[model samples]
Target: MIDTAASLSRFKRKTPRRVIWKRQGLAFLFLAPGLILFLLMIWYPTVQTVLFSFQNVGLTGSKGWVGLNNFDRMFGDPQFIIAWRNSIVFVLLSLIMGLAVPIVLALMINEMRRFASVFQLIVYLPALIPSAVGLLIWRLIYQPEQTGILNSMLKLVGLPPQLWLSDPNLAKPLIIVIMTWLSAGGSTLIYLSALREIPVEFLEAAELDGFSPFQRVWYVVLPLISSRIQIMLVLQIIIVAQVFTEPFILTQGGPASATMTPVLEIYNAAFVNSDFGLASAWSVSMLVVLSIFSVIYVWLRREDTGMN
Candidate 1:
């Protein structure tokens, strides 16, 4: 009887231990699919990109190992420099001027007591428009002739028919404007969500303290939503830096490569020039730059929070 009791106790303890191990095993099994997909899609490509950056690769074959020559070549190319400058300008414009509009618009929408859904729908409509269709519509409007929609409107106002996308001086800024218009709605939607998450008690307290509507928003709402705004700013910077389709379809990096961006340069290097190795090198550089930008944005945002 003593032996039976001891054996039963041991079995009970062992059973629970086995069950815990089984549960942990099942959890990892469930997670494996997602982990595998992430590694295959994200990690593998990154490793491949870094490797290809070093080799003297083309569409044909590996000519030889070119250590830093591809990067050196990039530095010497004036067009690459131009593209890099334009990319920086694009990132700055999108973050500062482009990002602010959405935040302001979202706040305005939140203040409305009626027709809120209508306002949201209208604000989001621009983002829903297909990119190709949007680009085509803007292309026609940006046409250099008086027959163009914008030039005709300018003529009505007694202003000169401007070469919106043709002139080197105006093309990049014009592209930036188009990007801002199309993308503002997405940012507004994000800010709207963040604004909604703010505690109503906070606003009420501000109101009772003799704070005006503007003051409440400026002091209370803005600070609370700052984190979301920072996240969106980083995302916008990354997207704008890699801007391709709009410029490729609309400008083709034309009028002396004025609106050319890094991604455009990468495409030209790989496909047009058939220098896949050099293209990969440029892509690697872009990745490094993007990673740095992301880190800085995160650090600055953390500092903002720490200050508050």
Candidate 2:
């Protein structure tokens, strides 16, 4: 009996299983198209960008490799320093003002019964406007030298006319406001969807228990949509950090480089100076910063869920 068992085990080990190969081969076939495109478009370019970050390659010819030289230049450049400062300030202010406003608007809209579609449309229509059109409209509104609507209003209210975009001090803050107005609609929609998914029975139960409107929202609604809030916070941070278009169109990073963001600096490096290597270095730095935030956001979210 022992010999027969050993012989059977040996035969099983030696036999070629067509089933295993067929299953694996089918899986590979299903995955091959997407995998090939990802390798070519994303992975390959990312590897090349990393390599370029370390080199001093020129447009016309190959230059000698200079490890970390571009990074050194980036640190020393006064413009780059200004860009870093502006990026931080812009993102901070936007997060404080723009980020929270959308949540509030979404909550209010969720509670509304009359003309819900109109309210949603009014909030979201700005997002659908072409960037160029929005830029032009805001440019007219923020026109300097008391020519804009805001300054005219100030004049009407018996106040001094203020420079909305021309002054370095006011330019960054004004940009933050514009960004908040234009960008918050998308977030509002996301929050609204989350709010809709919440069980109405739970809210009704809270109401039956003598919960006031504000109390119900505070304890029940907020807790239910906490995940959506977390996601929006991270996404807003990502978008605000990489802001370029508003600064470009509105301030041009000017009135003393008060609006120069990291992305703008990278654009100037690559296109204006035609320094692909240095641009790649700057790009890598921005990507690293974003990755750090992403990891922290994920870890914190997990911890928050675990505690809950």
Candidate 2 local lDDT, 109-224, one digit each (tens) = 98789977688889998887776678879989987776678889888999998877888888888888888778778788988888889898999999999999999989999999
Q: Write the per-residue lDDT of candidate 1 for residues 21-61, one digit (tens) a residue.
A: 99999999999999899999999988878887878888886
* lDDT (0 to 1) per candidate: 0.87, 0.84
Best by TM-score: 1
lDDT comparing candidate 2 with the true structure = 0.84
Model 1: weakest 10-residue lDDT segment is 299-308
Q: Estimate each model's TM-score.
A: 0.87, 0.85
**Residue ranges of candidate 2 with Cα displaced over 4 Å:** 1-30, 297-308
